[model samples]
Every structure is written in structure tokens, then in C-alpha cells.
Target: MTTSLMHTSQQNQPLISWRWLSLALLVLCIIAFASASTSWLRISPDRQLQISQLQYFLNVGISYCSWLVIAVFANWMRLRIPLFSEKHPKWLLIHCSVAALISLLHILFDTFMLGLLFSFDFNFVSAFAKKVAFWLPVEMVAYLACVVSLSLLEQHKKNLKLPESEQSYTFEQGNQVRVVDRQDIEYIEAYDNYVFVHCANERLMLKQSLSSLAAKLPDEFCRVHRSYLVNLMAVECFESHSDGQAFSRLKSGKCVPVSRRRKMAVKSSLAALHTHIH
Candidate 1:
């Protein structure tokens, strides 16, 4: 390739070799390693005695390096087919198709590279052959996780560009800006970039993630579920099931699920709200 052609090609190349990308990925890997080390009980016991710390780190480093390309591809895929679109069925199909394809490709590529580097026989096919069933689910889960995590980061960036108010929420809808009072909201349900705001008798939509919206809201709002943010003032009662599941029932008779992990927090919040009211 000529000099000008080489320069053009470099400009079009992927971000794998970028210094900032490397540093960010390294930090992510370090955090992952530390978390895994601390949560050893969750790890497979059989693999613990078999793999040395040095060997484990080397393998993790290699996996993460290759995952950088996959991550870039995931981000590209997400932008091409946004998380929330008008055609819900079509959107769901496309995401599933892409995720499956990526998972298979990642499994094959990662297996081949690992075999080439570590295995004596270098038989890539046999390495992940019988384990396709085993590895496919793991890779598919990883791919889905990657896509959702990327969406959060992408949403965070979009939030930074938008202006905020202390007492109300403002969201731009094309040329129109919709501002909703914080006190008027009964609850907020998350749907990717779109949030459905439920009032006493009507529901409205806003173009913002629940996380960003929750951050700006006052203490009256309580996150009862991953997808739900309930106004403490609107809650009629809190229900705790014997099966360990819990729910927040709003005065409007709407029941929002409270995740098992957040049950205690939800109980405490409700008790505090009740005490304050009394």
C-alpha cells in the first residue's frame, strides 16, 4: 500500500491498539480479577486447584484483549439497532440473531487462539468441540451482558449533554421539550432510553434512562425494581411473600416487584415513610 493509502487505512482501522482503549480495558480486567479473587466461593471448585494464578491471569488477559474487538462490534451493533424501537418484534429478532452469531464466533475464535497459545496439539476443533453446549450458553450470556452494559455507558454520555432541573424533569422530544413535575409522578418504568411515567390517571413517556432520572429525583422516589422507580408518597402498602419475593403496591393498585436483594432496603424505606407520615 502507498503512504496515502496506508494513512487512510489506519484512519479506518478499529480501536484495538488505541492507548486509551488499552488502559481502560486493563483497568476493567484488573477489577474483574479482583472481584473473582474475592468471590472464590462462586467459582468452580474443580478449576481452582488445577489453574495457577499466573496461568489464570495470562488467560484472562488474552480473553479480555480479544473481547475488546467483540465489545467494539457490540457497540456498533447496538447503535445500528437501538435497544428501543417502534417495531418491537423486529428489534427483538435482530438483537437475538446478532447475539447468537457473535457468541458462536467468539467461542470459535477464542478457542482457536487459546489452543494455538497453550495447547500442545493445537487442535482448535477438539478444544471446544464437545463443549459447544457448555460454552455457547456462557458466551451468549456474556454477549447479552456486554450489550446491556454498553447501553448504560452510552446513555450516561447522552445524559451529560442534556440540561437538568432541580424540581422537575425536562426531556426533549424532537422540537418540543416536555417537562414533568417530580411530585406529579406516581412511578417510572424503565425501557432502555425511554421511561414510562405513570401518574394518577395517565402515563407519559420520556427519553431518558431510569438510572439518570433516579439520580436527579428527590428522596420521595424509591427504586423498588430494576425497571421500576416508585414514588414513596404513592405507595399504599408493601407486601412481602413467604417465598422471599416482595412487592410495593401503590395507591393506584399497581404492584411493583421488589428484587430479593433489595427487600430489606425496601422494607426499611417503607417503615421510615410510614413513621414520617404518622
Candidate 2:
């Protein structure tokens, strides 16, 4: 009953909703412009000061828009987080580095335009300095706002429906199926007086017993605990304890306790299998 409830909840979650996010982003952009304009209008004195204010606002708007574009690309590409293990770190680093390079170039171009507007000759160093001067605070706030908004947007989408790329796997109450891809599995844990099948790629709940699942699993999997069965291909490491108990750590870094009864037999089976493969 609980497994069925969990499966239903997972099936209902969505990945993203662009329409709502677009509306929210539009509102934020309006608020930013309004706030900046209100401040500039209060500080300006003469006609020239008003012109300066216009230049400042225009420069800010352009910079913010460019950052928004970059943020969209980053979100679309699904850039990796520092500690996020689901995506590759190298790919994320490359994407962020390229975005940073483009943003820098954008600032340089904006500074040149701003200097030209004020009748100042655009020197290489001055253009860089002016760019840095305007970009720091605006970009900082823009980045923070983008990150927060994106997080909320992601949650909103998750509440709606599943992501497009994650293919759904369904099983009937008594159906038998093969798990061909070892990478699809997260960990198999005992649940609700039955076994639960979990996968990292998508949210799926299967109703079956550990004994039944053991028979269906490939040779790479072994019953490590009475309540747990592990995929050997996904094993990250193993740790031995003083009490003659041990744990099998998975690539996901989840450690499952091994039973003392199955210890020797499991070890021997793994050794024999490893030898046979080589």
C-alpha cells in the first residue's frame, strides 16, 4: 500500500514548466528596472545628470539581460553543481568557464558604449576598469536572483509532472521483468514487508519480495543482507568491522549492512565470479 502511494507521488512530479517561469522572470525584470529608475530619478540634478542616469539604466538593463540569457543556457544544459554527483564535474566546469568568458566580453562592450556616450575616448585599460566598475554589484545581485528563481522554478515543475527525458517503467502487481542496465539501479532496500526497486535515473516503485528479486537479478548482483541485495557492478568499496560484520558501499555511497550468516559465502561467490570474469 505504501509502495503504491510512493509510486503515485513520483509519477505526478514534473521536471520544469517554462510558462510559469517566463511570467515570473518577466515580473522580476520589471521590478528591477522600476527600482533602478526610482533611485536614479531621486539622485539626478540637472539635464546632464538625467542623461547620465539614462546611460546607467540602459547599461544595467543590457548587462542584466545578457546574464539572463546565460542563465537560461546554463539551466537548459543542466550545469553540474560543486557537490552534485548526478552530473559530470568537467562538463559543468567547461560550461561555466565559457559563460564567464562571454560575460566578461559583454561587460567590455558595454563599458566601451558607456564611455562613448559620455564623450570619453575608449582606452583599453579604461574600458576594462569601467566594465569592472559597473558589472560587480549588478551582476552579483543578478546571479543571486537567477539562482533563487531557478531553484523555485525547478521545485514548481517537479510538483507538476516528470521530466521529458526520464522514461517511465511500469510493472503490474505480479509481472516479472529483467533489469538489464546496472546503472539504472540506485539501491534495493526492504520495504513494507516486501522488496522495493529503486533507480537513480527515475522514480519507480516495484512490489516484490527480496527472495523473488534475487532470482531475477543478474549474476552481478548478490544478496548481501537478508533485507538487502546489491549490484556488484555498482559497488564502490567495502568495509570490514570488528564484530565480523561488513558493509557493501555503492557508487551512490550508500552503505548497506551485510549479515554474518551470508558473509563467507558471499565473499567466496564474489571472488569466484571475479576470477571467472578475468
Best by TM-score: 1
Q: TM-score of every model?
A: 0.39, 0.37
lDDT of 2 at 107: 80
Give me the runs in candidate 2 sitting further than 4 Å from their true place: 1-47, 79-89, 120-124, 133-278
* lDDT (tens digit, per residue) of candidate 1 on 60-101: 765686567566666656645555544344866776677667
- For candidate 1, the C-alpha RMSD (Å) to the true structure equals 19.2
How many clashes (backbone N, Cα, C below 3 Å) per candidate? 0, 4
Clashing pairs in 2: 13-161, 13-162, 14-161, 14-162
31-143: candidate 2 lDDT, tens digit per residue: 76776567656754575675566676666666656765666655544322321223344744555455566567778777666666666443667767766777654554554
- Top model by lDDT, which number? 1
* Model 1's TM-score against the true structure: 0.39
lDDT of prediction 1: 0.64
